[model samples]
Target: MQDIENKSAPTLDQILSLEKQVWTALVEGNAQADRALLTPDFLGVYPSGFANRDDHVGQFADAPTMKEYELSDIRLRVLSADVVLLSYRADYLRPDTETWEAMLISSLWERRHDVWINSFSQDTPLDQV
Candidate 1:
């Protein structure tokens, strides 16, 4: 854990890279890695409603998987010296799905005890036009 404030705040690229790593962990069903990236009190908002950290990580309990994923239009907003908001569009295919699904996602990362962890997240399904 590096102190971002003692150093300099992470750049957009770095944050985006971290975000991608989380997605990769999900796809690979690496619950431990995913846990490291998220805060203990993390809250996720989805079409199914709210999910806590355990709820999120528990999804990987039974050979969780993803077929493929693509991220685009990522944007980062600095909420404060220690908080950053990242928003992006994701196109992905789930394990049993042949067609791809798209969604707009926003995540909030907060620097705590020298480590950045995702504190909150929300996903909105994108309607096909």
Candidate 2:
């Protein structure tokens, strides 16, 4: 039996929790958690390259490159019962260097099967532009 929580829509706190989980998984190199959060058809156009959900979760889990994936000034607005938008500045310490790097990140979220998942995202270097 599936023990699912009965909720009408995602609350702001719940959305934040989902985001926190993803960031936590990234920092700890836990790809399994990431896989659970991401939709199977997730796709992204990152500065590094065109990546899919499997690419990110698998690589982050296996190599463990990214560190300290922190989100600040997080603002979320509900677009609809099933959609939400989030904006925040993300900071991270590179594994190679102990320097804090940050970027402006905007993420779109969608509720599916009573779960919140990141549908799309675009990150721009905060210092550059």
Candidate 3:
């Protein structure tokens, strides 16, 4: 639904803002916000397995999945006029945990109806070794 006819790539800050919204949703246990950030056919690849949009949001059924998070070493690439790939290192704490975990994430976002929607993501856990 993006004005594909007049396509334009989003700035690094714009995509970063959108990605932060997703992280904020996780920390806040905001299913609605999480769902809104992802496309209906969103695909997520994780250490556990593949997850759809619903599966991603389902973690909040009981409580927030994350307590806090920080994204760093961010990088963005314009894949097309209306698509971008954002990659970064994320350090986060889980609910009730004092320990921190880290992962490398690559997220694919597409422009739709003038809005950026996350279409895909893959998380690679940092080796504890």
Q: Give the per-residue lDDT digits (tens) of candidate 1, residues 37-82.
A: 9999899999999999998888899875676899999899988878
lDDT of each: 0.89, 0.77, 0.95
User: What are the models' TM-scores?
Assistant: 0.91, 0.82, 0.94
Q: Per-residue CA lDDT of candidate 3, range 27-98, in tens?
A: 999999999999999999999999999999999999999999999999999989789999999999999999
Backbone clash numbers for all candidates listed: 0, 0, 1
List model 2 lDDT by residue over 18-124, tens digit each: 87887888777788888888878877667887778888787774556677777789888878778888878888886778878888877778988766888776777
Question: Which one is best on TM-score?
Answer: 3
Judged by lDDT against the true structure, how good is candidate 3? 0.95
Residue 94, candidate 1: Cα error in Å is: 0.3
| Model 1 weakest lDDT span, ten residues long | 2-11
Q: State the displacement of the C-alpha of residue 2, model 2, in Å, after optimal TM-score superposition.
A: 18
**Predicted structure 1, TM vs. truth:** 0.91
Can you tell me which runs of candidate 1 are displaced by over 4 Å?
A: 1-7
TM-score of 2: 0.82
